[model samples]
Target: MNQFKNGDKAYVIYRNPHTQNVATIQEAIITESPENNEELSLFLMDTHYPLQDDYAIYTTYEEAVKMYNYYFEDNEQSEM
Candidate 1:
């Protein structure tokens, strides 16, 4: 398990919950999870989201973009 302290930079591929089709790579900051003192959260888009395994959070923008391209671009082409 990766542990991040406050102010650590994180890169995430964010998909709007209300608009599923819209997605982008966004930078976030690591913060203490408000709901759980023992866990970490990603502060992005004015919201605090608990960091989880399924989020696929990356340490670098390039890593996040690579995953975004694979999921959004390459996946679409492969299905065609």
Candidate 2:
């Protein structure tokens, strides 16, 4: 499993179940991650506070980085 300590950046994509459209994508620092679990409890960067909602959890740090770029960098590239 990819280990992320506090302050490491992480991301999650929220999609609408009915429409299957992206509701929102959140990027945050790794505040807390339970042992042996896929969930990463976090402080939402948007609010800088813990979020009780769905958040992204990657098994590998590389996967997290790729997804972060997939949502952030890809959009930035398009906008330029």
Candidate 3:
């Protein structure tokens, strides 16, 4: 069974095709079950579509955002 619920929050890091960098790492809501029973998909609440189903699923909203911000910051630091 999937760990995510309909309103659960999650984070997905996707690479930008053009820049080959972090495209988007934002908070998402799980609106539906994942394609596979063992995996959880990222669902954009606004778009009403699954962004991706192959990443980490944070236990809380803060946790997910914190991880995203940290990664983003680390990438920025590396760019400097």
Error of 2 at 17 (Å): 8.6
lDDT of 2 by residue, 1-80 (tens): 24666667766554556875344555556655454334545655444434444455654557776876787678879999
Q: In order, what lDDT does every prediction score?
A: 0.86, 0.58, 0.61
Best-to-worst order by TM-score is: 1, 3, 2
Model 3 bad stretches (over 4 Å): 33-41, 45-53, 75-80
Global local distance difference test of model 2? 0.58
Lowest lDDT sum, 10 consecutive residues, model 3, at 45-54
Q: Give the TM-score of candidate 3.
A: 0.46
Best by lDDT: 1
Residue 15 miss distance in model 3 (angstroms) = 3.6
lDDT by residue for model 1 (12-58), tens: 88888899978989999999888987888889988998878888688
Model 2 quality (TM-score): 0.37
Q: Which of 1 and 2 is the better model by TM-score?
A: 1
Model 2: clashing residue pairs? none
TM-score of each: 0.82, 0.37, 0.46
lDDT of 3 by residue, 3-77 (tens): 667667766554565896555666677765456644444565455554334555565657766776777877798
